[model samples]
Target: MALIITDECINCDVCEPECPNEAISQGEEIYIINPALCTECVGHYDVPQCVEVCPVDCISSDPNMVESKEQLQEKYHALMGKQ
Candidate 1:
């Protein structure tokens, strides 16, 4: 997944359904992204929808789960139809 929920998340459910790939889910105290299902909205929207809707600004790229643009694009297309 390109983004992750920080500890700052107030357990708010604002960022869940906003995900285009259905990647976000509720965790212990906050939401978590399913990396395998997360395409970072690459082939769906122009920007990361989760990052835009997060009230606490708790979403950030996963440093340990790095991916290249091409890889992201492939994932996006795999999950969504290409234009």
Candidate 2:
């Protein structure tokens, strides 16, 4: 599943640079994760880098954008232009 940044985010600016897919961005009020570009760090890292560096623990899986591990891998491959 894609990750979601909750309102609890402190806007610490750490998560943005941690995202391997560059999915996290600064929103009007808080950081937002773009599900289209989010792969949960699959094909890159063992865990989501944003989640790992998030001090507030505001990052979590998005139920609405639920996806399996295979799907995330596919997305990662697509993003990297891999076969």
Candidate 3:
């Protein structure tokens, strides 16, 4: 599943750099994750790097954009132009 950054984000700036897909960015008042570009780090790591580094635990699975592991892998591959 893709991850979403909650309103609780402190704009700490750590999560932004941890996202392998460059999906995280600074929003008007907090950080945001682009579901279109997020693959939950399927091809890069076992876990979502942004979630791993978020201090307030503001990052979590995006319930609305849920996808299976194979789907995530397909996304990862597509992002890298492998599909």
Candidate 4:
């Protein structure tokens, strides 16, 4: 599943650069994760970099945007232009 940044985010500006897929961005209030571009770092890293670097622990999997590991891998591949 794609990750979501909660309102608890402190806007520390750490999570943005940590995203391998460049899915995190500064929203009107807090950081936002683009679900379309998010793949939970499946094909890039063992863990989501944003979640790893988030000091406030505001990042979590989107229950509403639930997806399997295979689906995330496919999304990652597509984003990377892989076969």
Candidate 5:
């Protein structure tokens, strides 16, 4: 599943660079994750780097874009160039 930044984000810009997929971005007053590009670090890393580095620990699973492991891997493959 993709991760999301909650309103608790402190706008510290800590989690943006930690994302392997470049999915994190600055919003009006906080950070937002692009669900289409977020694979929860499936192909690039073992865990969600954004969540690992988030200062406020505001990054959490996005319920709106729930996906299984296979589905997430498929999405990663499509984005990273594979069958």
Candidate 6:
């Protein structure tokens, strides 16, 4: 599943650069996670990079956008042109 940034975010800007897929960005308010580009760092790291660096622990799985590990791997490959 794609990770989401909650309203608890403090706009710390720490999670943006940590995303290997560049899925995290500054939204009108707090940072937002793009479900299309998000791979939960499956192909890059064991854990989601954004979740790793977020200062407030506002990042979590998007329950509404749930996906399996295989789906996320496919997304990662597709995003990297490996598929």
Best by TM-score: 2
lDDT of 1 at 22: 92
TM-score of 1: 0.88
Greater-TM-score candidate between 5 and 6: 6
Against the hidden reference, what TM-scores do the models get? 0.88, 0.98, 0.96, 0.97, 0.94, 0.97
Q: Model 2 over residues 1-83: C-alpha lDDT tens digits?
A: 99999999999999999898889999999999999999999999999999999999999999999999999999999999998
Descending-lDDT candidate ranking = 2, 4, 6, 3, 5, 1
lDDT, each prediction: 0.84, 0.95, 0.91, 0.94, 0.88, 0.92
- Alpha-carbon shift of residue 74 in model 5 (angstroms): 0.7
Residue pairs of candidate 5 with colliding backbone atoms: none
Candidate 3 colliding pairs: none
Candidate 3 root-mean-square deviation in Å: 0.7
Question: What ranges in model 6 sit over 4 Å off?
Answer: none
Q: Write the per-residue lDDT of candidate 4 for residues 1-83, one digit (tens) a residue.
A: 99999999999999999888899999999999999999999998999999899999999999999999999999988999998
Candidate 3 wrongly placed segments (more than 4 Å)? none
Whole-model lDDT for model 2 versus the true structure?
0.95
Say which prediction, candidate 3 or candidate 5, comes out ahead on lDDT: 3
The C-alpha stretches of model 1 lying farther than 4 A from their native spots are 81-83
Better of 1 and 2 by lDDT: 2
Residue 29, candidate 1: alpha-carbon lDDT = 74
Residue-by-residue lDDT tens digits, candidate 3, 1-83: 88888889889999988888999888999989999999999999998998888889998998999899999999999999997
**Is candidate 1 or 3 superior in lDDT?**
3
What TM-score should be assigned to candidate 2?
Answer: 0.98
**Candidate 2 residue pairs in clash (backbone atoms < 3 Å):** none
Q: Which of the predicted structures, 1 or 6, would earn the higher lDDT when compared with the native?
A: 6
The deviation in Å at residue 44 for candidate 5 is: 1.1
Model 1 clash pairs? none
- Write one digit per residue (lDDT tens) for candidate 6, span 1-83: 88889999999999999999999889999899999999999999999988888878999999999999999999999999995
Once model 1 is optimally superposed onto the true structure by TM-score, how far is the C-alpha of residue 37 displaced, in angstroms?
1.0
